[model samples]
Target chain A: MSRSALGLAGSLGTTLQRELQLAFSSPGRIVNPLMFFVIAVSMFPLGGRMSAEVLGTIAAGVIWVTALLAVMLSMESLFRSDFDDGSLEQLLLSPQPLYFHLQVKVLAHWLVTGLPLVVISPLLGLLLHLPEAGYGPLMLGLLLGTPALSMIAAIGTALTVGLARSGLLLAVLVLPLSIPVLVFGAGLVDTALNGLPLTGVVAVLAALLVLAGTLAPLAIGAALRISVH
Target chain B: MLTVANLGCERDERVLFDHLSFSVANGMLLQIQGANGSGKTTLLRILAGLNSDYTGEVLWRGQNCRQTRQEYQQALFYLGHAPAINRTLTPLQNLRWFCGLQGFSDDAAIHAALQQLGLAGYADIPCHQMSAGQQRRVSLARLSLSAAPLWIMDEPFTALDKQGVAELEARVDAHVTSGGAVILTTHHALQTRHLLTVVNLDALRTESA
Candidate 1:
C-alpha cells in the first residue's frame, strides 16, 4: 500500500477495533440496543391478537419503528463518551481528516447497534407472522437503510454531544431526517406484500445510503467541531 | 511559530478576555496562568484552533491557522483538562489507539512511553483499575510519544504525584530545549528553567473589566 493508504488503513482499523472493544467490554452497551429492539417489537404482538393477518399488518411498520428507536437509543453514545472524556478533543486535533474518522465511527455504531437488527429481522418477522416473501425485503432493506439511519442520527449526536443529557433532544433533532429511511424500509416489505416490483424502493434506499455515506460524515464532522468548541 | 494578535473572547454575553495578545516561538515555553473562570482553558483552546468563537488572528508561521489547519494540526499536540483516558481500555491500548488516530501505530514506542511515565507494569491493566494519577500518567505518556512541534496542555499537572509533576516538568523543559514550543495552563507553578514566558489571563480579565 501507499503511504496514505497505509495511514488510512491503520487509523481505520484501530478506530473500528477501539469501538468494538469499547462496546463489547461493557456488555450493557452492546445488549441494551438489541434488547430494546426485541422488547419493543415483542410488545406490539402482545398488545393485539396472534392472527397472522393482524400480525403481518403491523409487522413492517412496527419493526421499522422499533429499529429506528433502537438506533436512536444508542445514538447518544456515539459521541457522548468521547466528548465527556476529552478524546473528542484529541480527535479534533488528529492530523487525519475528521470526516473519515467520523465515518468510521458511524460504521462502528451501525455494526454494534444496527447490524444485529438486520441479522435478527427474519426471526422477528417470523414472530410477527410476517409473510415469508416479506422477510427478504425486510432484511435487505434494513441492511441498506440502517447505515443511513446511523449516519443521520450521528449528526444529531454530534450536535448535542456536549450537552450533559441529549438523548431526547437528539431524537427530536434526528427523527424528521429519518422519515425517508423509515418510509422506504417499511415500504420494502409493503411493496413485496403487494406483489409489486421492489427495485424502485430499494434503489432509493441504496441512493440514500450512498448519499449519507458521502455527505453525513462531513456534517457530523462539522457539527462535532461546533459542539466541542 | 504561533502568534496571536488583539484577541477577544466572550462567553454567555460576559467578556472573558479582550485585546489579549501573545506569541510563542520555537524553544519556548509559555505558561498561561489564571484564576478560576479566567479563560486559561479557553485561550489555549483558541490557540490550538479547537475554539474559533473568539475574535482576532491566530497565525501559524505568519499564515492564518484556519487556512493552514491541516499542517497546523499535524504539528500540534493538545492535552485537554481531562486526560482522555477510557476506563475500559488499558493504558497501552489507549495510547496505541490515540497514536493510530493520528495516523501511526507503533506498539513498541507506546510501550516505551508508558514505561517512561512509570507505568511499565501497569500497561495491560484496564484504566479503571488504576489510580487517578496513574490514569493521568497514561495521558502524559503521549507527551513522550508525540513529535509535534507545538504542545498545548491544559492543567497537565492535575492528579499527579510530586514525582510525576517533576518528571512532566522535565519533559516539557526538554521539549523546549529541543526547539519545540509549548503553551500550557496550570494552577500549579511550573518549575521549568527553560525560556519561560507567562501569560496571565487573570490580569487580562481584570484589565478588560
Candidate 2:
C-alpha cells in the first residue's frame, strides 16, 4: 500500500499493542474480569442444590450470563483513562477515521478479556457439570458471540466514559443490547446436546457479530466525540 | 488558513462567549487571552472541531471544518489543557504511540524531539516517576515532531519553568516563521515578536453579555 495506508495499519497495530501492554502492565485490568467470570460461574453450583443433570440444564445459561457480566465489568475502563488524559482528543484529531481505530480498541479488548473467558469456558463447563457435548458449543458460542458483546458495550462505554459513576449506566445501556447474543449463545449449547443442527443459531450469532462489527464503530466514534466535548 | 464566523458557546445555561469571530492566516499566531473559566479552552476546542456544541462556522481552508474533517484534521494538531501523557508508559513509548496515531512512526525523530524538549535521559522512564514539568515536556515534545500546519494548543505553557517557557516561545516563533499558523491560550506573556493577534475572551464576554 501507499504511505498513508501503511500508516493506518501501523497505527492500528500500535494501538492493539498498547491495549495489551496496558492490560498486562496493570494485572488487575485483565485479572479482575477473569476472576469475576470464574467466580461468578463457580457460584451457580454453590448457591443451588441441583443434581448434575439439572445443573447441566442450566450450565449454558449460567456461563453465558457470567461471561456477559464479566465483559461488562471491563467496559467502563475501556475509554475512561483515554478520556481523562486527553488522548481521546488526540484520537479524534487524528487524520485516520476514528471508526477504524475504535474498532481496533474494541477488538483488542475482546482479545484480552473476552477471549480468555472463551478459552476457559470448558473448565467452567466441567465445574457446572455441563454435558460433554455442551463444552464444544459453549466455547464456540462464546468465541463467535463475545465480540458483539464487546462492540455493543463499547458504545455504552464511550457514552458514559465522561461520567464519574458510569458502571450502572453502562449496564443499563448495554445489557439490553446484549440480550440477543446471550439468547443465541446460551441456546447453542442446548441445541448441540440434543443433536440438533446448530447452523441456525450459529448463523444468528455470526450475523450479530458482523452487524456489530459493521455498525458499532459509527456509534462509538460519535459517542467518543460527544464525550470529548 | 482558519476562519470563525460568529462562533458561540453556552454551558449549563450560561453563556461562555457569543458571536466570536477571528481568523489566522499562514505564518501568524493568535493568542486567546482570558482569566480562568472565561472559556478560552472552550474556544480553542471549538476551533479544533473537538467541541460541536457551538453555533456558527469553523472554516478550515475556506471550507466548513466539519464538512471535510479528514483533510482538516490531517493538517491540524490540538493540545488540550491537560497533558495527554499516560503515566504508566515511558516518554519514548508515549511519543511512539502518539506518532502512530498521527499515522506515522519514527523512533529517531521521537527521541530527537524528546531531547529537544529537554527530556534526554527520561525517555525510557515512566512518566509517573518524572516531575510534573518533565511530564509536561513530554507532551510538548509532539510540537517539535508534528508537521501539521495549524497548531491549536490550550495552555501549552502550563507547568514549564521560565527557561522552558522561553524555549517553547522560540519554537512557536519558528513554527510561525515556517509558514505555519497557531491558536493557543496562555497565562504567560509570550515573547513572540511576530504577527500576533490577541482574542481577549473577557472583552468578548462583556460584549455578548
Candidate 3:
C-alpha cells in the first residue's frame, strides 16, 4: 500500500511489455497479416498476359497496394480486442497520459504487424519481378511508411472500436487518409525503378512518418475517449 | 469531496435520468440501486468522468471534474462490467499493467493482493484458463491494490460466488472505514458495517420521465 507510482519511463515500459506479450500470445495476429500480404502479392505473378517487364513496371504499385491492404485489414484488431474485453475502459481511466498508451499500442502494433510486412516485402518485391534498382527503395520505403499506416489506422480503429460491426466502416474511414501514403510509398520504388534519385520520395515518406508519429497519438487518444464514453 | 448538481443524461433519445444530485466524501459507501435498463451504469460512468454527455457538472474539490481531470482521475478508480483483463495475459501480468497505468509498479503489492484473492497459484497462468468468477477475481484484486481514494464500479458483484461476494463486501467495508469512498451498482444485497447510501435510479426515472 505504501508503494508509490512510477515515472513515465517505468509505466511506458510496462505498457509496452504488456502489449508485446499480448501480441505474442495471439500468434494469429502476427501470422494473418503476413499470410495475407504474401498470398495477395504472390497472386500478381501468376496472372496471365503480362511479360516480366510489364509485371516489373507495376511491381511497385502491386506490392504497395497489398501492403496497404494488409495493414488496413490488420488495423481492426489494434483496438478491437481491447475494446471488447473492457481493458480499453480501464486504459482510458488510467492516470497516465493517454498519448503515451496510444504510442505504445501503435508501436507494438507496427512491430508485430507492420514490421513483418516490411521485413518480408523484399522477397515479395522479387516475386513480382521488381526492377533490380527498386529492391532497396521498397524495403526502405516500407520501413519508413508502414509506421504511418499503423498510426493512421490506429486513429480509424479507435474511432470505430465501439461499433459491433466495424468491417467496411474501418476501411472507408482509413483508406482516404492512407492514399498519400500509398502514393508516396509506391512512388519510392517506382522512382527507383525509373532510375531517378529517391531523395524526394524518401524525404516525403520520412516527413509523413514524423507527422504521423507525433500527431497520431493525440488523435487516437481523443478518439478512444469518445468511443469509450 | 465529490459533488453533482442538476445532473441529467439521455441515451438513445430516451431520458435515462434527470435532476440527479449527490455528494460523497471520505469514508462513504454509496450504492446505486436500479432495475434493468435503469441509469445505474450511466450514472457511475458520469461520476467516473467516462461519459460527458450530461447536463450538470461534476465537481472535485470545488472544481469541475473535467476542468481538473488530471487530478480528479488521479484519485479515481473505475471497474466496469468487463473484467478488463486481457485473456492472453496472466493474472500477474494483467495486474502489473493495470496498476502500472495508475502509476504504481509495486510488484510485491500486486503479488500479495493476488494471493489474498486466492490467486497465488493461478497468478502466472493465462486468464482464459480460469473460470468466470476467477477471471472476475483477477480484476477485483485491484480493489485491494488501488491507492485511489474514489472508486466507481458497475455491476461488480455479477459473477461472484458466495465467498467471493462476502470477501468483496468486507473489502468495501474496510476501504470505506479506512477513508476511501466507493460508488457501485449491484443487485446483490450488501452486508456491511458502514451505513450505505442508496441512489435508486428507478424512482428517479418516474420522477423525471
Candidate 4:
C-alpha cells in the first residue's frame, strides 16, 4: 500500500484501540449510558401504566433519545485527549489531509461507542415492550444513523476541544444537529411498529447518513483549524 | 527550496502580519522571532498549508505551495508547539502512524528512526507513561524518519531540558547538513553554523507594515 494509505490505516487503528481502551477502563462510562437507556425505556412502563398501546407508541422515542444521549456522552473524548496532550496540533501539521484523518477518527468513534449501542439496543427495546418486529428496523436504523451521529459529533468535538468543561458544550452543540438522525431512525422503527412500509423511513435515514457523511468532515475540519488556532 | 512572497495574514479583526517576503533555499535555516501574539504560529500554519486565510503566495521550488498542497505537504513536515503524539499509543505506534501518514511503510526505517531518537528502550511504552521529554522525543524522532525536505517547527524547544535541547540542536545541524531546510520560531537563540536567517516579527511588523 502507498505510504499515505498505510498512515491512514494506522491512524484509524490506533484511534479505535485508544477509544475502546478509554471506554473499557471507565466502567462508569458504559454503565451511565446503559442506565440512561434503561431508565428512558423503563419510564415508558411507569409513566404509561404498562399498557401495550402506550408502550408501543412511545417506545421508538424512548430508544432514539437514549441512543442519542449514549452517543453524545462519548463524543467529548473524540478530540479531548488529543487536544489536552497537543496531538491535535501535530495532526494539523501532518502532511496528510486533515479531512481524511478526521474521517478515520470519526469512524473509530462510531465503532467503539456507537456500534456497541446498536448491538445492545435490542435489550433496551425489549424494556420498552417494543415488539420483536421492531428489532430489525431499529437496529438497522441505528446502524445507518449512529455513524452520522459520530461524524456530526466530530464538529462539536472540534469546536469544544479547547474550551473548559466542554462536555456540556459538546452536547449542546451536537444535540440539535443530531435531530435528523433521531427523527428518521425513530421514524423507521415507528413505521415498522405501525405495520406501515419502513422503506421510506429507512431511505430517509440512509439519505441523512450520506448527507452527514459528505458535509460533516469538512465542517469538522474547519472547526479543528479554528479551535487549534 | 522554500519562499514566501508578499505574505499577509489577519485574524479576529486584527492584522497579524503583512507584506512579508523571504526565501530559504536548501541547507538553510530561518528563525521566526516574535512575541506571544505576533502571528508567528499563524504564519507557520500558512506555510504548512493548514491555514489559507492569507494574501500572497508561498512557493516551494518556484511552484505555489497552496496550489499544490499535497505536493507541498509531501515535501515538508511541520512540528507545532504541540507534540502531536497519541498518548495512549506506544512511542513505536505513534511513529508508525506518523510514518504511515507521511507515506513511509518500511518497518525497518521506522525502527531505525526511533532508535536514532534514543527512544528504542521506550518504543513499547505508552506515550502517556513516558516523561514529557520522552513524548517530545517521540515527536522529534520524526525528523529522522521523514525524508521531507522542509521542516516548519513552532517553538519546538519549548519544553525540552538541556540534554533534549542539545540533542535537538544536533539533529537540526545534521538535517541542514543533509541539505534540508528548516523554518522555525524559538525564543532562545539557536547556535547553528549555517546560513541561518532571523526574521524578527516584532521588527518586521513595525518596519514592513
lDDT per residue, candidate 3, A1-229, as tens digits? Answer: 5587689888888899998898899899999999999999999877777888999999889988899889989888888878888999888888888888889889988899999999999888788788889889999999998999999988999999899988799999988999998999999988887788999889999999999999999999889889998
Please, what are the lDDT tens digits per residue for candidate 2 over residues B118-198? 788889898889999999999999987677999999989888999999998999999999999989988877798797899
Per-residue CA lDDT of model 4 for B1-209, tens digit only, reads: 88899998878888888889999888888899899999899899888877778999999889998677778778888887778887777877677666656654555766777787777777788778988887888888888777888889988997788888988988888899989989999988797878778888889878865
Report per-prediction Cα RMSD to one decimal.
2.0, 1.8, 1.3, 3.1
> Candidate 3: interface RMSD in Å?
1.6
For residues A97-180, what per-residue lDDT tens digits would candidate 2 score against the true structure?
788899999999898899999999999999989989889889999999999999999999999998899989899999999999
Distance from true location, Cα of B81 in model 3, Å: 0.8
* lDDT for residue A73 in candidate 2, whole number 0-100: 88
Candidate 2's displacement at residue A222, Å, is: 0.8
**What is the per-residue lDDT of model 4 for residues A1-229, given as tens digits with 9 covering 90 to 100?**
2333455556556545555565565556556666666676666677745577668667778888878877787777778877877667666666677776777778866776778788888887777778888999989998999899888888898898889888888888999999989888988887887799987888888899889888899999889888876
The ten-residue window of minimal lDDT in model 4 chain B covers B98-107
lDDT of each: 0.89, 0.89, 0.89, 0.80
Say which prediction, candidate 2 or candidate 4, comes out ahead on lDDT.
2
Model 1 Cα lDDT, one tens digit per residue, A9-72: 7888888889888888887877899899998898987896678798987899999999999998
lDDT agreement of model 4 with the native: 0.80
Task: Give the per-residue Cα lDDT of candidate 3 at A43.
Answer: 90
lDDT per residue for candidate 1 within B35-125, as digits (tens), equals 8888888988999888999998999999999999999998999999989999888888798788887787778788888888888988889
What's the residue-level lDDT of A217 in candidate 4? Answer: 90
Kindly give the number of clashing pairs for every candidate: 0, 0, 2, 5
Candidate 3 accuracy as lDDT: 0.89
Clashing pairs in 1: none
